[model samples]
Target: MTTTLDKRPPGAHARPTPPSKGRGFNLLRYNLLGGVAGWLWLVVVLLPIYWIVITSFKVQADYYATNPLAPPTNPTLDNYRFVLENDFVRYFINSVIVTVGAVGPAVLVSFMAAYAIVRGSAASRFLRGVNGLFLMGLAIPLQAVIIPIYLIIIKIQMYDTLGAIILPSLAFAIPLSVLVLSNFVRDVPKELFESMRMDGATEWGTLWRLAFPLTRPALVTVTIYQGLTVWNGFILPLILTQSPEQRTLPLALWSFQGQYTINIPAVLASVVLTTLPILTLYILGRRQLLSGLTAGFSK
Candidate 1:
């Protein structure tokens, strides 16, 4: 068997080259697309805010004399002063009162309802089905049912009072509050509930002592979320409240927007004033609010 011997090294057999790790996102190929896209989005959002702030500082003459997009010729607080002079403080107080009155009770009631829905026996048809009814409210637009709300308010003689807005806002906010809180409550471990029960804790005791503390994040989320809605609400106030004294900040803005003309500077100034509280709140509770909003999605 005079076979030719192979003349290859034992370890020198052809080895496949490891695939080259591709170079990271090529800035050259992408050509700053992401940066441009980000700036475009940022401009879309921040431009209106800038215009509002700048307009709020402009005098009426400067507002018209200069270009619409131009900065105020001479920046001043006069526009803000003008807005405040027109019973702005009173309207602010009304908005604050209505928001507090509505959001507090609404959140409290919604939390209790959510807790019941989550912890109640599945054998109880009403408790099991109540969550679906609450979720259905999400599909029902407030505008679609405003007429009935208005009539109910009128029949109760609650029209033209802050209660007019509060009651309706509470009703609208309740469904959302219930939805969010129930999702959060449902996440609480069944073992925890059983443990509490084993310790002789009643349902109410479990709710406050166990559930409430655990769901604090969801509570904060609902409070701020509902507070913002009630604070900026206009339609309910316009229809349900007939008097200037009962006007919310949103309704009060129309006082600057008469039929014949509009005071852009004053209107923007009012917008700034009205948005400040919400901004402040977001700054304070944004973390907990965001955490609460995301904490419940799984079974």
Candidate 2:
């Protein structure tokens, strides 16, 4: 006791540890309010989807007779059959064409523009100006410009055609795509770009080999976002196309509703079918979409 030897390791000091909070105190800190809010929101969203699925399976009579949310006693494929038999296949194909046509070119052009803006904005006032133009486009709502767009489509003799829908959709899609893509492109390390240049890689070569690979999550995000916009696009298809043959899914769904006003089951069935492709696409690209969004926000 009088000559107590120092027992601690030479480099190790006795550090004070954080006092332990009991389980009750830890539990008190859990976000109960947030958890409750999230559950409420989940129910709000899923309830209608639940009703839609259940109602789609019911017969027209059963739709009126049974509870709206109840599963059908005799679930029939008749509603789906009815929808498919009514040139649903043609409208589906038209949607595919319009979505692909618009999204492909829009993404391609936006990617190139974004790459140029990020790479050249420092030295080029024009590139910076172009970026400003894109930012301004985000402020311009489609409704405000629809009249002008319609007039241009008429002037170009593209009105009442899928091309009319695709062109406007492509134009509208570009602003947001460039905005998202440019941020991702700018996040690439300047050192890596320098290394590429030192290795005699052209900007074009580096864009594809380096930037493209690194920024693929953003590309997928843009593609899916724009694709969904074009896919469920009601106003453009309605104004731009007049023929039944030119109708995309949203326009087709509207027409389907008008044609079968009393057949709620059939209407919901078409809604489900129309949504399937989009749902499939989202499922496929959801990971990339989330990662892209996270990366964007983090920066």
Which stretches of model 2 miss by more than 4 angstroms? 1-30, 297-299
After superposition, the stretches of candidate 1 with alpha carbons farther than 4 Å from their true spots are 1-31, 259-262, 296-299
lDDT of 2 by residue, 1-299 (tens): 22257677677777898777686666765767678889999999999999989888899999998888889999999999999999999999999999999999999999999999999999999999999999999999999999999999999998898899999899999999999999899999999999999999999999999999999999999999999999989999988888788999899999999989999999999999999999999999999999987995786
* Model 1 lDDT per residue over 1-299, tens place: 22258566665676688865654457444668878888999999999999999988898888888887888878898778877888989999999999999999999999999998887737688887787888898999988999999899999999899988888888889999998888888888899999999999999899999999999998999899899888888889988988888998888877666721557887888889989989999999999988886776433
The alpha-carbon root-mean-square deviation between model 1 and the true structure, to one decimal in Å, is 5.1
- The alpha-carbon RMSD values of the candidates against the true structure, listed in the order shown, are 5.1, 3.9
Question: Total clashing residue pairs per candidate?
Answer: 0, 0
* Number of the top-ranking candidate, with lDDT as the measure: 2
- Alpha-carbon TM-score of each model against the true structure: 0.86, 0.90
In candidate 1, where is summed lDDT lowest over 10 consecutive residues?
20-29
Model 1 residue 223 CA deviation (Å) reads 1.8
| Residue 39, candidate 2: C-alpha displacement in angstroms | 2.3
Clashing pairs in 1: none
> For candidate 1, what is the lDDT?
0.86
